[model samples]
Target: MNLEELREYCLSLPHVTEDMPFGEEILVFRICNRIFVLTNLERIPVSVSLKCDPERAIELREQYPDKIVAGYHLNKKHWNTVSLEGLPPTLIKEMIQHSYDQVLAKVPKKETLKFI
Candidate 1:
């Protein structure tokens, strides 16, 4: 998906917000102020970094060598850099959900209540 579509999808999730905390060129999507998705708006071949289950992350990397890889500047075992070309949109949406859920899971109950 394109950047606009990706941004809209992330925002469609409950309590998700887009911010430029780092800068205007890097779009970050957060839930409860915890980031789950990031994109470089200035780059061609739109891509996104997403959190993933450690084991699933490895599996995806092995399965989609060209489209998926270890996340840049993130824990390689738990995050992935996903290339948004030739990848199914449904799979991308599922990955986005996984990233969002992972971030939500880390939030303490009190903080999560604020989003709820």
Candidate 2:
């Protein structure tokens, strides 16, 4: 997906909000005010960082070495940076959903997730 397409997908998630806390070029998406996905707007072919299960993160990197890698400027064990240059859009969407679910599961409020 393209930048606008990805932005639309992210904002469609319940309780998600976008911010440029780092700068105008960096777009961060948060749920319950906790960041889950980060995108570099200035970069071509979009680069996004998403939280992931530690073991799953390693597996993904090993499986998609050219497209997925250790998170940029994030805890290497819990996050991943995905290059959307040629990866499947469905895979990217799943990545975003996993990140959202991982964060939502830790929020201590199941009722809040019902709205999503």
Candidate 3:
């Protein structure tokens, strides 16, 4: 997916909000003010940094060496930077969903209801 598609998909998730807290060029998608997805608006070919399961993160990087990598400036054990240009949209959406789920896992159950 491209930047627009990525933006729309992230927004489509429940309680997701778009922000530019890091500045105008970096787009962030958060649930309950906790970030799940982020991207650089100025980057070519579009890419995203996503929260991910540590083991799954390693598997993904191994499976797609060039397209998926350790999250830039993020905790390498729990995040990944994925290039959107060549990957399947379904996989991209899954990663976003996983990130959203990761955020939900950390939220209080009652507070998370706002998303449902």
Question: Candidates 1 and 2: which is better by TM-score?
Answer: 1
Predictions ranked by lDDT, top down?
Answer: 3, 1, 2
What digit string (tens of lDDT, one per residue) describes model 1 on residues 3-96?
8889889999998988898888999999999999999888779889999999999999999999999998889989999998889999999999
Alpha-carbon lDDT of model 3: 0.94
Per-residue lDDT over 1-116 for candidate 3, one digit per residue giving the tens place of the 0 to 100 score? 88889988999998888989999999999998899999999988788999999999999999999999999999999999999999999999999999999987999988877766
lDDT of 3 at 94: 97
Clashes of each: 0, 0, 0
Clashing residue pairs in candidate 1 (N, C-alpha, C atoms within 3 angstroms): none
How big is the positional error of residue 110 in model 2, measured in Å on the Cα after superposition? Answer: 9.1
Question: Which prediction has more favorable lDDT, 1 or 2?
Answer: 1
Off by over 4 Å in 2: 110-116
Of the candidates shown, which would achieve the greatest lDDT relative to the real structure?
3
